[model samples]
Target chain A: NAGVIQTPRHKVTGKGQEATLWCEPISGHSAVFWYRQTIVQGLEFLTYFRNQAPIDDSGMPKERFSAQMPNQSHSTLKIQSTQPQDSAVYLCASSLAGQNTEVFFGKGTRLTVV
Target chain B: SQLAEENPWALSVHEGESVTVNCSYKTSITALQWYRQKSGEGPAQLILIRSNEREKRNGRLRATLDTSSQSSSLSITATRCEDTAVYFCATDSGQGGRALIFGTGTTVSVSP
Candidate 1:
């Protein structure tokens, strides 16, 4: 298995521009998760989906950040009007559909907001 | 403060030596997991210890979980240069739809 696949291993966006990251989860996995990692914040949970439905997004910023799982195979995270502070590695993961399941993560897409 | 915190932010050891990484969490959890992330790679699971399990071993890697203290530890024995990585402990809240909460991570450097 290729595990989780995240496109655009690296992204560079001008400040105030929009950035969209794509993720394709592992086959047959029913849980997909998104997290942001930075040297300062470590790994921060952003959102997750189960059975192709959004389950929790409490970690998402109050505005300008959104995620969607339109289907079981794929998901997306979009950041609007990106700022330099938003620069970080975005990781996408998939699991076997349970709270106790071990998650498999992709190499991550490093978003650099200039 | 983070929900999970790892102690001794970083450590250095020679090959064949043993190293231990400690983690303390803030809330109750059903399962705790230890992950190792080598440079330029995503984190990989090393071991998963449930609340009922006090200790679990995988090859040369050992993990201990103390539910009462809300803490867990991971020990790597006979470490090699390839074992150099960042270790993190993650907590599963046991609540539906809740994801794993990760600690900041402990950097382990093994030199030959």
Candidate 2:
């Protein structure tokens, strides 16, 4: 298995521009999660989806950041009018079940908002 | 403040030596997990210890959890260069749905 596949791997965008990150979860996995990693914040959960439905997004910023799971196979995180502070590694993970299951993560997309 | 925090930002050890990393959490949790992330790679699960379980072992890795103190530990025996990575402790929020709260992580360097 390829585990989880995240596209682009790295992205650089001018401030105020939009950035979109994609993740393709492993086959048969039911839960997908998104997290942001930075030196200051460590690893923070942004949102999650189960069975193609958004379960919780309590950690996501109210503005500029949004996530969508259009299908069970893939999900996307979009940041509009990206700011320098938005730069961080966006990680996507999947688990076989919703709770108490081993989670597998993708390499992550390193976003540089300049 | 982070719900969970790992002690010792970084540590170094020679190959064949043993290393231990500690983690403490503020709130109650149903389970705690240990993950390791290598350079340019995503974190991978090492072990999962539930609140009821005090200790669990996987190969040369052992983890201990103290629910009363809300602390956990991971020990690796006979470390190798391949084991050099950043280790993190994640706690289940106990609200269910497997929402994990992660710690800052401990950077471990195992050298030859």
Candidate 3:
């Protein structure tokens, strides 16, 4: 079902610039999640959406970071004034709305801030 | 510290050999899942062990859960080169709308 699709497999941006990552979740899935992966932090949770509504964003950076799911089909994560430390692979996952369901992930978008 | 964590940060093995990865969690959970992520790819689920069950098996993989100890382990037999990847253990609290908490991951390398 195309699983999950993340646009711009790789991205490079200058520090202090803005970068946006896009994710298209699996069809018919009601839950979508965003995560950042790095060697030091591994897979760190950033946020999630249920039925197009944000559920939790406790893992997200309170400043310079934001995520939105305008519809059930797609979501976006944006960073303002990106810094070198913000570079990492951003992963998107989706699953049916339920407890302990299998979550399918996309290949991820590698964001490199130079 | 992470809510879930894996030990033996990295390991190496030969084809046809076996290996085991262990994990420990700090909180109560309804299920523990094992995921493998290969180079340039996203993590894929290999096994899911529930709190009520002690062990679960899938093909050449076996997963064991110990609720009292808040630990779990994933064992792979007759490993292959394609088995090389980073394995992560994630815990699901079973709370409504809660996300699965992932571990740091253990890197496993299998050579021919």
- Inter-residue clash pairs, candidate 2: none
User: Each prediction's TM-score against the native?
Assistant: 0.98, 0.98, 0.98
Count of clashing residue pairs in every prediction: 0, 0, 0
Give lDDT for model 1. 0.92
lDDT agreement with native, every candidate = 0.92, 0.94, 0.93
Model 1: how far is A46 from its true place, Å?
0.4
Window of ten residues with lowest summed lDDT in model 2 chain B: B92-101
* Residues B1-112 of candidate 2: C-alpha lDDT, one tens digit per residue: 8889998999999999999999999888878999999999999999999889999999999999999999999999999999999999998665654678899999999999
Docking class of 3: medium
Q: What is the TM-score of chain A alone in each candidate?
A: 0.98, 0.98, 0.99
For model 3, state the Cα shift of residue B108 in Å: 0.3
lDDT score for residue A81 of model 2: 98
lDDT of 3 at B102: 92
**Which pairs of residues collide in model 3?**
none
| C-alpha root-mean-square deviation, candidate 1 | 1.0
Best prediction by DockQ? 2
